[model samples]
Target: MLNKTASRSFYLNLWLGLVGLVVGIFAGFAVGISPALLLVAIVAVAGLIWFFASFEQAVIGLLILRSSLDLFSAQQLPAAFAIALNALTILYVLVALLTGKAVKIDKFWWFFALWIIFQSLWVILLPLGGLGMDASFLMSGVRVWLRYFSWLMVYLLVMQLKDNVPPEKIVSMLLLSLVAPISIALLQIFLPSSMLPSLLTSQGKAGSNVSGTLGFPNGLGIFLTMFIALVWWKLSISSKRLPWLLLLGLVSFVFVRTGYFTGLVAVLLLILFINSTKITPVRAIGVVLFCCAFLWMFASTEFGQQRLTEIYDTPLLNPNIDVSRSIILSYGDSNSFNWRIAHWTYLINAWSQFPILGYGLDTSPLLGIRDFNTGSGYAPHNDYIRFLVEQGVVGLTGFLCFLVGQGWYLVHLLRNSQSVNSRRNLCLILIALFVANIVSMLTSNIMDATTFFFYWWTLVAIAGWGNEYWRPNLATKSA
Candidate 1:
């Protein structure tokens, strides 16, 4: 018994989604719309779907562009798309309260609900809307919240629809998401530098292609790390040789061109974590051997060699004499370690200026001080710094409180997990993500934007889902 609006929304979503897919799937920038305008259209369509179809349509939108659109074009939309989906999801969830659906909220949903409410309050109380009725600022808020809403929707959808969704479907969706990014990264690796500029022109940034698929080299590394971890988990659950083989190939290619050591750390941590899972020793050994082959390939490739050279080229990690020391220092030595140290220093120093309320909600870029390194008008590379700069200390504190509370909740779930095997596996994945975030934040500080933000929230929701779904059963078994 669907209402008329719901029914109409579904049909419109289906048709509009198809139109978007057709336009976006091929070339020519969707029949004459400038790349920028096409991106806006994509965002608009995403917003419409999210508003009407709950979070389901948001996922559909993500899938549409992610699977069909060319990487060059697709990257533009995902960041905006994620934000749109998140906002709509949050709005819908809040609205559901009037329908008595509030009773369905377990503890995890409650935490998410609180986060949404807090964000809304911050939006209202602070200068989030900007000084006046600026369409650009308004649109930006819409985009930011969309990602948060998307993750919420994903979590709610997964938890509620867990029974309805086949394992294969879940696996397929995730696999597809990673596949597009991996393919693009591989292209960057194998393709000539002369050819890269055209593909990367979407970023419209000067100098160097900004690592398509994940939007940067480190970002791509994160994607690879997550996929490799996922593939390991899948292998533990099922013995599908093809997925393992394919994932191994993708993972190897990602690391070779990443030029960042984070992937190596992620892979190492994932392997250790998987070993702790109940995966068979035989399978684990096979994975290790497979990874080694990929490592060897990484070392052999031209791109791999270049990336490898960069690893040793720096004196930051290696105090030993490295030829690239002068070059890195010229680029800004103190700011080079992802600029976390330098950026954090600046943010801390600047906090007293607006300590309590901060610079107003999402006003870091406005301050002009945080954009020191790239000079591209970006948020602080670290979420902590960005949160403080944008939301101020008060807003940042609220967010931290929420995160810490969620972690405490996870502890209870971990202790009470029904199946030790699944629980352990879940723990491993969560830990890997946590560690990855630590590395990203400590070094680079790039988590608050785009698909990376989407990844962070999705992982959180997944952790919450696993906790709620498995805890009671695990507790009973332990007892």
Candidate 2:
């Protein structure tokens, strides 16, 4: 009778605890915190709880939050979301350490950490002969490092959680998150501007380009390119292939409408690479014929004609001077292409002045490279050049080492992974994603684009997870 009484007390107390927790959460919401923030808080708490209970659920929630961020203007979101994620990451690492989980630390992460430390020191010291540091510039540099570190934290979290989550689940969560963005993008393309939210409307030069919920057409193109590769890879290994292929076709069409030449080229190269092993003499001839036919058909369209005109109208070639110099000098100061060239030239010049360490993070714009018309400082669109001008040889070297290390690890996984076919397909997708990103970086400041950076690292973390936990002999392989 005493034992029964104690059990009843325990159950009642447990129920009251849960009820009190819910009421407390409601009370906080009722006290007039912004709905956005309240929502983030609720999600964060739930995610933390889920993280402790089930690692896979926490990862899925994180991915969903990350993907949803693209739809809204990032500036409007609360910083609490990032704080929550970082807190969870730190806690997870501590727990893993306490529990003796075999946490693998990639050497690339150390290099990246060194790079961040170097930037932090440079910002603090404000060394002589560097770009003059002001409070505003210093704060901006701090913000840059904070953002980089936040993303890096996510990468680290994924590394720790990789063994706990299945690769297929990661892919599924990514695809599920993509559904809303993809649907919105396709709708914007078909629907009139009046039917869409102003935020979702096309802001590109032509009314035809759709940014979807990503807020930038080029960003959408990059996002689509990565997923298109993913969907294509998924189709290649699936029996229910037609639907995925159709989705890929739709995504490819939208990607072209973005009119981002670099993204398009990257996707094309990815497709070519994927098909390289299948090419036979007969298939090669057929491929060439199909390409010729497609080109002929494309030339007949008004849109294609405009695109061709834009390409040909550019002064790419001149007969009056040495070919190389003429090509180099052809870009007019006012031309967009020339603008990028000018930025690159300026960055190169700036890097030459400080070859070893450069001006420091976020200092490129302040170093007297202003737009002539607006007199506003501009960033070099190319990340490589920006790194050269801002972080210099030491920083750039660290950056390169990280990239090379990541590539090596991916390759190593591909060669040695005896995982299920789904896992291998994911590995291939990661390789393709890396290639596409590298190519896209040539034309855009990809590292600075938060949406792309988050997705890229998240995917990498997923791949790493697959490498560790998704192998055939693992207990969860069947999962």
Candidate 3:
């Protein structure tokens, strides 16, 4: 594919860069040149070369998508988006045609399929039709599909890896990802907005504790809960020198400081449940002490003190302004809880109207009520309510299959699983993470698509795949 001229240009550029870097380094001694300048130049050249290499790599990834992903454009999405669904469809067809083996539809698949059918049917039957939802086709529809596309890729990757990868490897990846979000959260909480120009530019807002790569405080809280669960799971069974205790304490501190009530509750439950499994009174006291210390650390900080004082004075302290809107307009205060309540009320009303199919897929409960400023009536604060609104009863039922199935599955796995320390620990970890995600979703509606959904699906895939560890030869027999 490479032309001789282009190949020559590439090699020439590479050699020129190498030679230039060597000259710049050597010249620093004789010409009194700054090594920092030489280093910067080399870095710049290396970065340019790497950018070219990434282009080639991205092209290969895109090619595997069979033209679904546009690699040549500057505004391109990841190839994984296209590759995921293609892989699933190919798997299904191959199983059907070549082997004459019909893909046995499980209850989970039935739920999902029914939900999709209901969504399609509703779209067709609506008086205004699908055109109503496609009003902001570019922004809303495109964004929703892109997120689902991302979810598809993540689902495929985890499912494929289910058989081969060890639980520890998955746990490790989860632990490593925690660093990025935690680091970003810490920066936002501690650093001035003007300090990180790049992150500020990307995020569109700064100086708020909740503003991070995830774009919301609640998202970050959810992430923290999941990450700590991973750590807790790893620590419970391993004899290795893991700093899980320290991690638990640190994350708990961040969780409380985040002001995300659900996250705090999830973490507390995780600690209590895990420790109570063995029923050590000493550990129980330690947990209580740790909770107090965590509370104390928050109360010591100015923000923490004010928040605590406000909570303490909630009943007595009059808001003196409308509390039913997302943006609270009280003097010296801003609260969105009232708006969530109103939106939730509106969502409940919407559900009552379309009890069976709801208001079509991707339609938020607050879909019709436009925001005065941005006109974006998208995404209620609740995931379960949002699912009911968009997918209607069918969607809710399908999701319930996943929710209730996972719960039953976790209990079944935990009870019947081999009584090995590592396996038991892994089971508990899964349970904690599952509980944390469900709890987090109560306050934030993120399961549809986003990093939250990706992580949730990854955990589910891991559960399905990892279950075989406890039931050896099960897949072979099922196949």
Candidate 4:
């Protein structure tokens, strides 16, 4: 029976591969994109063939492509090509799980599972709620809802690696993954604008803040921040931290060069909090001085000067004020913070109509159409507004509960930390990120930033696996 099942699966995958290759070819040709992109399409098809051949290969392939796909969005690649790849990704992972493939499932898994259930329900019923009836709107919302599945897949696959793969092997894989993103950052920094493809670049000045592989400066910030934390954890535990010095330096350079302040701000706060972990006073002082020096350099940059000197016209709240989106945007020097405030105001008003279950997942862009003159909407920017507008009150409630539980769990781990330096450092970084996220999420997309979260949750899932694998030791230590 197993042989027959395998034979059938192979045949089905073969059929799908042929169809996919044909479609990918047409997609490449239809766009009349450069020959270079056509070559990429060929490579993509070849990669897909490998993915379909084995579940393990598919999982690993996704990890390897984590950074690239972030840059090669619908903006870089054709929309059809991007959707096809993402849909195929979702299909393969879901099929594997349904076919009795086991994954790590514990207390946190329940939290993840329950909230995910609501996402599907939102997709099906959003049209009825008068939110996602238009084809584009409905499809957009569906894609956003399904985005979680991609992260779920990453978490499950990474968890599986804990026992079967050695830590050094995973470290090596991460080192390999670092290549493309850092290379792109260097290109953006050194190469002239005319030398790079428009798809690979954004509207940043030549000398400052460029989007690396993640397509946006902030996205690069998030990825590099998580990556830096991972490196720190590795070095913290290793007897010979010297080996990681070069890798650390490369990552740090790209991180600083990108000039996305979000991750830096978060890490700066974290460095101060690390004193609670009982580092030497001298080391703590050194960290403070290093941060201060970096801040001085950062503030001296033209872009940093603009961001720092800008003022928000709208206060956080006021009973008497005409703080509409247009009004907020009218100021020639309007801060992005005020823009978020205006967009959020419009989203909240529309969300009031569907307060129970929200209009639909990812519909916030369309829901805030009233705020946009171009008749196109923007992201809520704030994850709180995102959940409140799309997932509604119930979803938000579930999310907060899950967050509180996660924070508690991390605290518990830190308090009763075993003799493992790596694990303790892991808990510290996670907790710091958790707290930082609470602040960042108020102004950034924390939940559905797939490219960034894909890596973030992979590290997190390793911690989840560690929680189970080291339970006996932890229990003994607690006793």
How do these models rank on TM-score, best leading? 2, 4, 1, 3
**Comparing candidate 1 with candidate 4, which one achieves the higher lDDT?**
4
TM-score for every candidate vs. truth? 0.66, 0.77, 0.66, 0.76
lDDT of 1 by residue, 1-479 (tens): 46855765665566556766775664356547567776766766666655555544345345435432334445565554445555645645544543334423357777887787776654564344433223345546555555466666656644543433333344446666765666665566566657766655453222322355555666666656666766665554554558666776666666655655555665666666556545677767876786687678667755556556655435556677343443444345432442334445556667767676665445555543444576655466567777776667677898688667766766665565435544555555666566555556544545453455454444444554444344333222110
lDDT (CA) for every model shown? 0.55, 0.65, 0.55, 0.65
Give candidate 1 regions above 4 Å deviation.
1-76, 79-104, 128-143, 193-210, 277-335, 338-340, 365-375, 418-424, 453-479
lDDT, model 3, position 458: 60
Over 364-417, each residue of candidate 2 has an lDDT whose tens digit, in order, gives: 776535856888887677877777777788778877776787778778766765
> Candidate 3 at 368: error in angstroms?
6.9
Q: Report the number of clashing residue pairs per model.
A: 19, 1, 2, 0
Q: What does candidate 3's lDDT look like per residue over 227-280, in tens digits?
A: 677666666544552477788776766666566555666777776665666756
Q: Could you tell me the C-alpha RMSD of candidate 2 in Å? A: 6.4
lDDT of 4 by residue, 115-184 (tens): 6775677777766654423444677776776677656655655665556654434544664667787888
Which of the numbered candidates is closest to the native, going by highest TM-score? 2
